[model samples]
Target: MTQFNEDWKSDRIGSALRGENPLVITEMSSGFAVMGDTQFLPGYCVFLPKKTVESLEALPMPERTAYLSDASLVGEAVLRATGAKRINYSIYGNTDAFLHTHIFPRYHSEPPERISRPVWDYPAEHWKSNDDSYKEEQHGLLRDKIATALTQLMEEAYLEKDV
Candidate 1:
């Protein structure tokens, strides 16, 4: 086992920056795109800033804009990769408190009750269930797809800046 897999949760952003986080899908201009731990919602991902900060409001305006823009870019990539009906973006610093965004893909096939509710509204077991945990054999393809989409989007954005 790798040091990161065993203790990455202790410092997600730090490990991601070191390229030690196996969950990392790609590194964005402003952050890193990481696959969520559970697959309760397939294609679920998170955007983490380059450095640690308690909340988004703590960042300067330019950094804040980049973080937020990166979040939406991750959302769009999740949507395109997962083919979800829509994407839900969230930023609650309650747990990790590292100024990150959660990108969830909402699908039309979800139960009627769950389709409209917040991802947190789902039972807690959903977050910890091994059945829903990310497995390379099962989710690696999806992760690759999301990474590819995000990389392309970023390239396009950079090209636009040059033009």
Candidate 2:
């Protein structure tokens, strides 16, 4: 079992910035797109701002807009990569006090009761148990899929803007 530094839980963005976190899928203009540690729901990801900010509103307007756009791009990628029925976008800084977004891919394969509930409603062990975490191989494939999807979407958006 790989042991993570205790600081990682308190400074996820910092860990990613320092190259200590292996979850990073790709870096965006405003933030980094990282795969969630757990794989209970495949393609789960988080968007973390490159600069530390207590809340979303703390960012400059342009930065905030860029972060939001990045979150949407991540959601689109997760949707495509996972074949999810829909993606859930959430921003709650109560815990970490950092400006970040969680992008969850909701699937048709989920139980009927869970399909309509928030991802948080799932078993706590799903997030808390290290045993449930994704292996490096799995993480790499998922990261590639999401990164590829995001790249395609970005290119399409740029082409549209140019036209």
Candidate 3:
């Protein structure tokens, strides 16, 4: 797997969290959620946080609460955008200690990342090159969409509830 240095960290991440996808709706402090990069399954978005905080428990109380709130917001956005029957949420910090989450929209027949066995293993491919301009562009466009959606959601939430 390719390792990222501080420089990589300095560069913008989660630009995808922003856009006008049929899925993906917001970028939370703990992470952002957007439609999955691979179209094999639609409305598959990755929720990656802004900071590298490892375990969720490690976050300060206020941040922890806010993070969950954001995660839920993303979930609602995904549902609103995709009309999925259910949303699957997972947090796997194994790939990078930089805390992140996955917000997957599950249809009845989507294949499990893991099988009957609790232990799930699959082939991995590390990004071999930095020529991800397409990803960058996609991220930019998505970021705009998500931000707009989030703003609307926030207004509704704030008006309807005390939040």
Candidate 4:
């Protein structure tokens, strides 16, 4: 099993960002999928690659298949966990050098007060802080739930030789 590192340069960083949960949420096979730290957007997720491969074609056929499967699993987990109305997936590696997919869960009346603004544009204070141990623990719990769901998905997929 590949361990997720805290260094953002590494693809495993997404796992650490997911509060150390590799089960419900994790890096895709190429090693880039992850859950963001902010609950303000709730169910926000990302898929990142392990190596610095920019284009999707850079990945081998099997890896590409697994990557898509992993992305879908994470998106499904977020939808189930948050009961989100819709899931939005984006891959704009402009701000960050690492190529990653951003999965945003759109809700009925979410984003609190700054509903009109982009999630990144909102003030940092609008989001919950990861400073407190209790907050971290809570995030860990939610991450675990998602990880569990992802694991089940993997099992089902493999049972059908879909993995």
Tens-digit lDDT track of model 2 for 1-163: 2556667767888888887776788777788898887888988899999998999999999988888987898899999988999999999988877788999999999999999999999999999887768677657677788999998987786677689
What is candidate 1's lDDT per residue for 53-140, written digit by digit as tens?
A: 9999999999999889888989999999999999999999997867889999999999999998999999999999999998888998
Number of clashes recorded per candidate? 0, 0, 13, 9
Best by TM-score: 1
Candidate 3 residue-wise lDDT, 13-53, digit = tens: 43333232333345545555555444333455666556557
Can you list the residue pairs that collide in candidate 1? Answer: none
Q: In candidate 3, which residue ranges exceed 4 Å CA deviation?
A: 1-31, 109-150, 160-163
TM-score of 4: 0.68
List the lowest-lDDT window of 10 residues for candidate 4: 128-137
Q: Any idea what lDDT model 2 has?
A: 0.86
Model 2 residue 143 lDDT score? 73
RMSD of 4: 5.1
Model 1 stretches with alpha carbons more than 4 Å out:
1-4
Kindly indicate the candidate among 1 and 4 with the higher lDDT: 1
Question: What does candidate 1 score on TM?
Answer: 0.96
Indicate which candidate wins on lDDT. 1
Question: TM-score of each candidate?
Answer: 0.96, 0.89, 0.59, 0.68
| Candidate 4 local distance difference test against the native | 0.63
**Candidate 4 lDDT by residue in tens digits, 62-144:** 88777767777778877887777777777666766655667777787865564544566656664556542223445666666
lDDT of each: 0.90, 0.86, 0.54, 0.63
Q: How close is candidate 2 to the true structure, as a TM-score?
A: 0.89
